[model samples]
Target: MNNTYITSFDYQVPIDKIPIAELRQVFIDDFSDHVDDLESPKFQNITLDEIEAVSVYQNYNPGTEVISVIEKVLTDKSDGRELDLIIDYSVVSKLENGLSIGNKIQEQLNARNALVLSVGNGGCLSFMLALKTAQAFMQANDQYKNVLLFSEDHVIGNRYNPGLNVLGDGASAILLQSETDSTMQLVDVECYNMGRLNPVLGVRHDLKGNFKYKEFENKIQPLHYKVIYDLFNKVLRNNSLKIEDIDLVLYQNMSHNDYVGLKSALQLSEDQLHYGKMKGHGHVFGSDIIINMCHSTEQGKLEKAKNIVAISSGAGFSWAVSLIKN
Candidate 1:
């Protein structure tokens, strides 16, 4: 694993609809009649201009989405080689009978010979944990040739959680190999878990079955800024790098205000951060950073960038940062 590389990656988000307005209307027409109640401030304050569009899946399950993303990656980038392991980072795992989502994905991929492992409950940071786990597996076992990391989440059952940004449906896949000629290379990774705020930002079902978005905003938002700032500093220090050395910082795709808050906290300029994906794609749970990176590379924004940092924060009170060099 001396020359481990992310050879190629691809992401899939259903684009049958455009702009957030259309999606909202579709939801309103199909689910509820009280439009004002659905658009209440307690749910979310995002405007149409702030969020251009989001992908939605009405008939696909998480396991099927995972398999679809894997097929896309293999068909478009891979060399028709079999994978050694498949690691899934789905926060909401849909279980049928007794089988888990990971097992269903493995069975669908026909990778019965490959090892399957799932990491859940880490929210947006789950994929970072999966990446770290894949690296460890490769380093520990020389026989493991390649590993695949997949992440996908959607707003199916918990659509009323207003503490979070507007939810979307999307999936991303990354292929890790021992030797490849890709420009992007994984340099270092770090993660921290602060469980003090675990219950502040998830779906709440009490007697009224109402959401606690206001409480989450009041209690967790301030802590989020501090935690992100500290994690960024820690990763920079641990890697012997400075803020100026980072060509691009790809943080999670939240609202515009959240991005501004982070930029102000870090005192970074617009050129130092890449967050244009948020307006068009919104937040896709664990796949936000990966989707941003892929789109940035495709748009040629990363051609001259030498070092990039990808960071994410999850509801479980976990933060992760990964340093990539090109």
Candidate 2:
């Protein structure tokens, strides 16, 4: 079951990246006075530098551009690798108004006609869906020597809610192959979902007419680490492995608090975790997993690991995990 470690994983992003936006502007029919006011120092004195420093609001969704970045990562190192994609339902679900996210992705990758080997919904279980997709695709396509696994998502599904700060707009691509190289190896995977907790994290509409974030300040919501730690232990127990055997623990960065709790719950030292810091990247939705992997590669932090486990949890009350040997 040992193969070459994940040799190279890369990513790209558009320069003109736009963030999800919200604005409160009242329209004025008699615009002359309003225009005069807008032209005053209150508005005119504002410099582009200051504006740039201030985060811009995103009114449009980022889809193909993000997927394009994922494809870039795949094709860059895909010379001898197979391609598999684990797409989160949120990327293309009608409820989120993302019906075209998947097809647009296929078009960006020139894979519109490619066989849909497997498809599943993570419901907030994005990580599990991804791993399940990888397992199924590998089993179904033995001849598929090189595989490309990818996932992309936007923050629009959460209605641009500020509470979902950890969620960002991004995409990820991992090139897999039958032969081993210097890259990280895909050892095994374990996944589960807590659908009962689905109501705690989601997008809902209120009288204001826009979607609102649900669970931003719930202290108990972070108890998800207990759920994740239990599932992780279950996976290790099933495979006769121990947490100490794991060299690195890559978990989704929900927030600083989640990371701290997960670290204590998992009994992991600080070095065992990847860059768990919550930057302004704004909770990249489902792309955080690969994003962290790519960051590790860039920082040369992935070495000295015999085994590494990746864990991801999302709002659908879902969880996905995988064990990789480096």
Candidate 3:
């Protein structure tokens, strides 16, 4: 049950949009109507739709591309180690019909279950997908010796939303299996969702009102932090752990300000919090948390700790916290 080590990781973003930071900021600006203080009167005059149009992330399908890179990455990283099971997800926007993503992967990988966490009308589909993936992995009879947890989201094509284009599509595949043969151990997991809200914070649509994205601000939406704090507290409390018990805090890829607020709330030290290639890769949607964990290991950050916690949050207005012990 011990001696797990994350061997390697592989990542690829379309060279066309290699610099995704610019796109991300554009989307952030488009959604900036919610900013505390608006400097330009022109922004006030612009409609939300106009702003959304500018923020869209385009090109590159993270789902299919993620799988290709992940299969190659995991296999290379495993270095001939035999896997007992694999858990994977190629999540795309509901507007994009993610079911096909799963089908595409099923063609390549030998997986027992294919779960899809559709956002419905909520924006935090990533959080929901992660929650589902963790729950399924934990509940399984441990019959599978190796598990591959994968996530991918692509922005272009379906016009998921104006912000979708700004989000560079990417995928991450993690090999999870017996602690004896595994690289990283899954210690604990927690999840919380904003039960009361309509979940869809942002909604966009075509001129015909077909469907775009109904937007919601995570900052203004207390539900984002509320569920996050609640889930984190529960995970620690149930495990009889204090904030200091965590060696490192791996947060979901989020805005810098949001990260600060979370660190303050969790009382985490700067050294204790880690984010890997997040800005460089843009948020890999649902793969953010897992990718960070893998990236941390690949970069030798996790080598120092025997215990770590991974916290993730997304638009379904949800929060998830998972702990691992090395």
Candidate 4:
């Protein structure tokens, strides 16, 4: 009841190939196509597969590439349908000057002059929250038909981050339609803000004059699972379903051990918790959940998913779950 409920949806879920939860994502890293391994050796064991940092982009304009990526997704996946609205979830979207990017996108994409809005919410959870916002907009009003929720992020300063997993950049474009059933439909959603763990934007200059990216994931580590347990239980209860009743559960990619710990804590079967994406992409900040959903569907893991649950937690200190029914 607290989340948006769209009555319609339309889209073909690809049983093969990389495509949404259809999704087209691109990562521009200084490390090239190879998984960029970090130089840090102290916490290597704890970080594990997530040690590879997608890093940053200095050559190409990130904003421009993001727009380009969105254009490609629209060209290939939009199916000639015009957009009703665009919700951008990214770190740069918070900039006062960054607002123009939205306008440029709207004008360039032939989106039919759809409204463009920015959601500066960070972390993977921010992406889900943005998706929920789009779903809610269509639910609350019928004027908006299909919505495009785009997420993009880049670390502005250092190439390697000691905080958590992702110290890189990525962009994802997802199409959410109204009044149809071909793609995943938003059944229910829940979001809770724990508090601000990272600054809204900008990097700090330390005594050495090096740009520093700060993260406070350690502060709430103790209460993390408790919050996840309660948040998920509420969403499941709202849908009148239980963990066993759901076919698949996907969480944002983090460390391999993090996934193992979460699966055990949530009492999820191996099939339910699909965290294999972590090995390949590491943590992609806000785009992790969307990419993971696309990964699961293409791998045919999502084929068995009827009442699938996708959840994520972000440095914005927010947790969110979106229950989708096939």
Q: Can you write out model 2's per-residue Cα lDDT over 57-149, one digit (the tens) per residue?
A: 244454544555555656556532134342433432222453535555555566633443323255334644655565556567664445555
Taking all chains together, each candidate's TM-score versus the true structure is: 0.84, 0.70, 0.69, 0.76
Kindly list the per-residue Cα lDDT of model 1 for residues 148-229, writing each as its tens digit.
Answer: 8887665553332332555677888888877666767777778877777666544211222244455566677767778778
* lDDT (C-alpha, whole model) for all candidates: 0.71, 0.51, 0.51, 0.60
Query: Per-residue lDDT of 236-305 in model 4, one digit per residue for the tens?
Result: 8998998898888888766677787789889998878887564434556667776777788679987678
Residue ranges of candidate 2 with Cα displaced over 4 Å: 1-8, 13-63, 76-100, 117-120, 123-125, 157-164, 180-183, 202-223
The predicted structure with the larger lDDT, 1 or 4, is 1
Candidate 1 lDDT (Cα, whole model)? 0.71
Give the 10-residue window scoring lowest on summed lDDT in candidate 4: 15-24
lDDT of 3 at 183: 42
TM-score of 3: 0.69
lDDT of 1 at 145: 64
Off by over 4 Å in 1: 1-3, 18-48, 76-81, 98-100, 158-164, 202-210
